[model samples]
Target: MNPEKALVWFRRDLRDHDHAALSAALSNAGQVYCAFVFDTDILDALPSRQDRRVHFIRESLAELDTALRARGGGLIVRLGRAGEVIPGLARELGVASVYANRDYEPAAKTRDIAVAESLRAQGIAFHTRKDQAIFDGDEVLTQAGKPFSVFTPYKNAWLKRLTATDTAEWQCQGAFAPGPAEGIPPLEQIGFMPTDLDTIGIQPGMSGARALWDAFRAGRLARYAALRDYPAIKGVSYLSVHLRFGTISIRELARAALADESHAWLNELIWRDFYFMILDHFPRVVGHAFKPEYDAIRWAERPDWLAAWQQGRTGYPLVDAAMRQLNYSGWMHNRLRMVVASFLTKDLGLDWRLGERYFADQLNDFDLSANNGGWQWASSSGCDAQPYFRIFNPITQSEKFDPDGKFIRRYVPELAAVPNKYIHAPWLMGRLEQEAIGVVIGRDYPGPIVDHTQAREETLARYAVVKKTG
Candidate 1:
């Protein structure tokens, strides 16, 4: 039996197609109304008014609204806490049900529960569907029905469990009920300012996602495994922001990866699902270590070093360049992300949570699960993490990945004249060589903040507590 009237409360899933909640509403209801809340519960906590993510969402919403209107419906947008706004809007519209895609973040899950309770009180059914991941919850559990903590087994299970129907699009068959004529509000109207999204080469809507996917499919997917680790080349898809915001469909991407037999790229997508699964099964990883004994390790209190890392003045060329790239562009290459995270936790002796929070603040495609997972992996605190003894040599990573120093010079331009011989470690240059290159180590490019050899020994000692307890 179809519902008389239904409302679709859009959250992270922004697009009009292949949307689980939207398709369910349109298919099951006589008429459907769509709305999106700016969510002050989230917006209020943002540290900056000119957030690229906010701007990206605003632009994406405008396009979504336009797309819906073409199908004889429009989007209703509001600015308030979703808990209050969704129920109130559902009541006013006289909806029998409210449909939405599920969110996995602890805060978001909590928010959804409150909203559901409110809707239930008003006699409106609250239905949620999975739209973000290929598999979530216990769908991809182990043979004994327990959640898999390790990724390789999880990936094997994820692939083995896949079928054509899993990647099929959720078609919207029923007609949409027209929304209130008031359109989407501008960024300023919603208490946000325009950002350098255009300047930074970020194309924010469904159109942008399609363009990037097309380009990557046409050229880069074949060589992604070979060239993806190098930060200097365009060997990877820049579609992460689109994926984060649901401007593109995960199923669509997975299908393409499978069709092209690009197992490496498909493996990355599977990792996304794995992180979501990890967060779902082990929510405690949010604040504390996944392996509890890791909490005993004492992190250093080096405010100056922390500040240097954040400001891209760490003096290690690769680390500095990666930080600068993140600061300026709001995106960092995957390989550089690992390198910088290792440098922060292992070399600088800081807590992984500190680095996790910083990446959460800066990354354009910041998914809490992936951010936490990567940080934990680097710090040897989470499931299937690297051994604590493994520390990245920033110079070797730079040399191996950016052999010509192109990436370093692009972000840390003070070393523009540095010869290839000393480019990876400008501090290694003799004074005469530094003079010839016009890059004095201290005055031009700062020297390495901490000696790698000394930091490695310190890190080993610091993690000894974990070893003893384990």
Candidate 2:
């Protein structure tokens, strides 16, 4: 007997091409339908209405609907809880099964389970495919049959295990006529406001990801190794937001990396997979430290310090500039993310969770695993984290990566008049020099909020609780 119909539920994977569940549904079922849930269970929890991520997702969904229409199918969009919505949609469409790409985040996984159980009760088979990561949690285990804590070994094993078949793209083409043609809801209809995404020159959808990939391939791929660390340069691929939303396929990216010999960039992709594995194997890392002993170390109750960091008035040029960039564009350079995270946890003596939660709210491309892993890595509280003593000196980092202060000047324009020599540390400028520049250190731009030298010593003392474990 031939399969009657199937539903492809879009989650993080938003595009039409190279989709696992969509391809499977098309191959198995006589008719296939596509749908997306606004998922108020998640959306209502957002702290702001002007969220860039929400705007990006909405735009991408519109594009997806258009793309599907061209293929004789269209998206079915609903705004409700997925557990209730998916089953209802499946029943309405009379689908034999519901297929979807897997989402690995703790909350997403729980939701998927609930949806699966609901579909099972209705006698509708619910199937999930591996589309997000090249390797799943169990794909790259160690010699001792345990998940890896360190990245280097995991990456080595991942590379050794990789084959051409693993990187091959899943071709999802042809017309799927049975799909519904409902139009996407506007931002206002969904209770979200327009954000600065467009003003910041961010393009949404698959076309945007393709354009970015083409630009990166033509201009930056060759010199990515040399230029990626410098924030002032357009060195890194700007496809991060696209990757987060699955506007582009991970397999396509990995394939392009291999074809272009972009080893450094490929390593970064592997790092992403590593973090996913960590999140899957150690779920508690979401709220607590990976190394439990590190949790014993005390964090300061300094709301003023956190507020200064958040508002970009910490008085350190690099850290302040990074925060300002995040505040303005909803994105930050990776190198600067680490520097600013270090300043927050080590210099300001605040908990890493504070920085993590702040980033969760601010970043347009925020992935729970990557954001949490980055914060714990910066705070020296996660597996394979930098040593506690190896704190980042914000001033030196500024002078080195952004020696000409080009990045600093762009984000923290108050320091534009200061000479290159004093741009990284304007507080060092003599009163006459500050006056000559038509900017006063304390009046125009605030002085250093906390002395780095003093903070470094205090951070070391505070981390003494984990000294034996070190």
Candidate 3:
């Protein structure tokens, strides 16, 4: 039975192709109208008006509108509260139903509920489908019928449960049902300004996602396992921003990886699902420790140290370099993310929330679940987290991952002229050596904020409240 009209609402799932809600709406309705909400409920909460994610979404939506126009429909974009706007749009279009992809964030869930209720009040049907993750929430659970807190068992079960149906593309066949030709507003119209996203080497929209995937597939996929750890090399796919924004579908990415011999990249995608599941099942982890006891461990209140870390002024080379990269570009190497996260939580003895908040503001690909999961993992306060005793040594990490200090040099140019031996710890250079290199430890670059050895011992004692053993 085909509905006379339907409205397909675009949220995080921005792309036109392989879109579950769009396909469902187009197939079931005689006329399907598409819409996207800028959602002031979300935008007003953002700390900055020059947010890169905002710019990225704007660019992606422009392309999406173009794509939808080719199918005899156009994207209806509005800047307002989604709860109010979605139902209003449905009423305006006189649609029988509203179709959308599911969002799992706590606030998003609440917003969706409100929207659903509003639509119901108007006697309109509202439908949502899983498009972001291959298996979200409890789809992959343990033998005991519980959500797996640990990743390995979850991954194993996830693989076993996978069938062709799970990865099959929701092909949007047939012409899109025609609707009003509303277009996206400019960034300035939405109270957002242009950012340095392009200058920092990021491309927004589905075409950009495809371009990055194609490049990654051409050569880097074969060496991803080996090179991904080294920040000096282009080992990682750089598709994370696209994934977060849903410019590309998860099914397409997973299916592409399945065709290849390597499964390392696929594991990363599974981690994304795992984090999402964790967030859905354990929403308390958003503000509290996942493991209750970890909360007992007191975090240091060092505003000065926090400032240094945020500004990339920390004395440790690798930590500073990673933080600098994040400050300069809206992204950082994944390996450096772990290193800096550990350094912030352990070495600095500061609250992980501080670093998490900073990353939330800085990362181009920030997702609340993934960001929270990563910070908790580094702090040993999350499920399947690093052991309380397993603090990362920033110096060793720098030497191992960036042997020639190329990554550090690129971000921390003050240490560019320092010798390879002293690059990771420029303070170790002798007075004569410093003079020879024309780089003074305290003058050219600030010294380490805190001694690593002393900080390590202090951190061990501090974390002993949670666990005695490293």
Candidate 4:
């Protein structure tokens, strides 16, 4: 006899603990089949064959399969378009229904719709749950029953309505009893080559996420507010990578933050939801601006500047260091992400979309909504975005954030010999002083790409077309 089958289709949310679809599948059917599809719709557009994210995803899935197999279950991995494959797999397994967590991207939403329709045509029910974010579509709203264009009001309402009921942990493996089996495709079989991070031991699974979460709760949660700006302090929760893969549950993290006294950490989580909510309401922001009038402003394509930015040769210590980190590691510190994004748009006078695409390409934690929202915010084109005139001063930013020049020194080793006073702006130091440090601007270190003074003037003029100020 065929087991009373249900298939849980894993997308972003990868963990067995606090997984809604996995739990629902366990309860609704006698036996559950778990699967993940490396959707080609997303993968085909990626320029990098050596994508660290693809490797990260495969590693996470490998761990997921092991955990599932330990509990009389297994994860079946497939590489194809999910819309084409999920329904086919469902029919093959003879499942009554398919369950999955909701994804908010416009393309993803369209793909899921197609998948759902395909399953429905075959008499297989497709069920989806809001797993990645705290507030799903229409869950948090104003008194006016309109989607929020601003964040603070939305965040307040989101907090006001919150209870233990709002952030409940999902319990997997309640009562399902099925035969344990090893599952999932081999790493190379999935067409993703291994990443350097795999060897560096960045910790890529459920256990790693739990370890980070536990450590964050015990030691770093209190200092998060003060030290998150300083990348050298190790104050920020390294959970962005985990959160990107859904190796950890958003509800569990939210619950922990909510229970804790610090509102700072909760604010970061709120930013995640805020971006997710923005994406759901305004999918137009993905390729364009949330505020459309900014579209009128002509942005320079400036591929040369873009190439320099990507290569970390921007000739600004802070900006160059941040880019080097991103180029080398698939991660960029959140604070530096904001700083570099602002520099690209408001300093170099380059298009925000270029920087957005760069972040999308390089960031391991790159979620479309968050990355888009961030770039647009820096460019003053997002909903409730910053004003155009408020450009980041890279030198001041470096001096303030990396006060002792620790972050810059780590990535810009050429500037290692420079005195503390001149580290942030080596070009400002005298040639004799530079010689003493065995450093020469335009030789050992490149000169500033665009003088901040000239760049600031150019940025202001460029944004004059889109300025909203009265």
Q: What TM-scores do the predictions have?
A: 0.99, 0.98, 0.98, 0.96
Extract clashing residue pairs from model 2.
Answer: none
lDDT of 4 by residue, 1-470 (tens): 33578999998988888888888888788778888899887888887777888887888888888877778777777788889999998998888999999999998999899989999999999999888988889989889998888889988998997888768887776444342354566557766666797564578889889999999999988788998999767898889989988999888888877777668999888888889999988888988888888887777778888888888888999999999998888788988998999999988888898889888888888889889989999999998888888889999999999988999999989888888898899899998988887898998999988899998898888877776532
Considering TM-score, where higher is better, how would the candidates rank from best to worst? 1, 2, 3, 4
Candidate 3 steric clashes: 1
The candidate maximizing lDDT is 1
lDDT of 1 by residue, 3-79 (tens): 59999999888899999999999988989999999999899998899899999999999999999999999999999
- Estimate every model's Cα lDDT from 0 to 1: 0.93, 0.92, 0.90, 0.86
lDDT of 2 by residue, 33-63 (tens): 8999999998999999878999999999999
C-alpha RMSD by candidate, in order: 1.0, 1.1, 1.5, 1.9
Predicted structure 4: lDDT: 0.86
Q: Model 4 residue 317 lDDT?
A: 93
Measured by TM-score, how close is model 2 to the native structure? 0.98
Compared with the true structure, the alpha-carbon lDDT of candidate 2 equals: 0.92
In order of listing, the candidates' clash counts read 0, 0, 1, 0
| Candidate 4 residue runs with Cα over 4 Å from true position | 1-3, 174-182, 468-470
Better candidate number, 2 or 4, judged by lDDT = 2
- Models sorted by lDDT, best on top: 1, 2, 3, 4
Clashing pairs in 3: 315-448
What is residue 327's positional error in candidate 3, in angstroms? Answer: 0.8
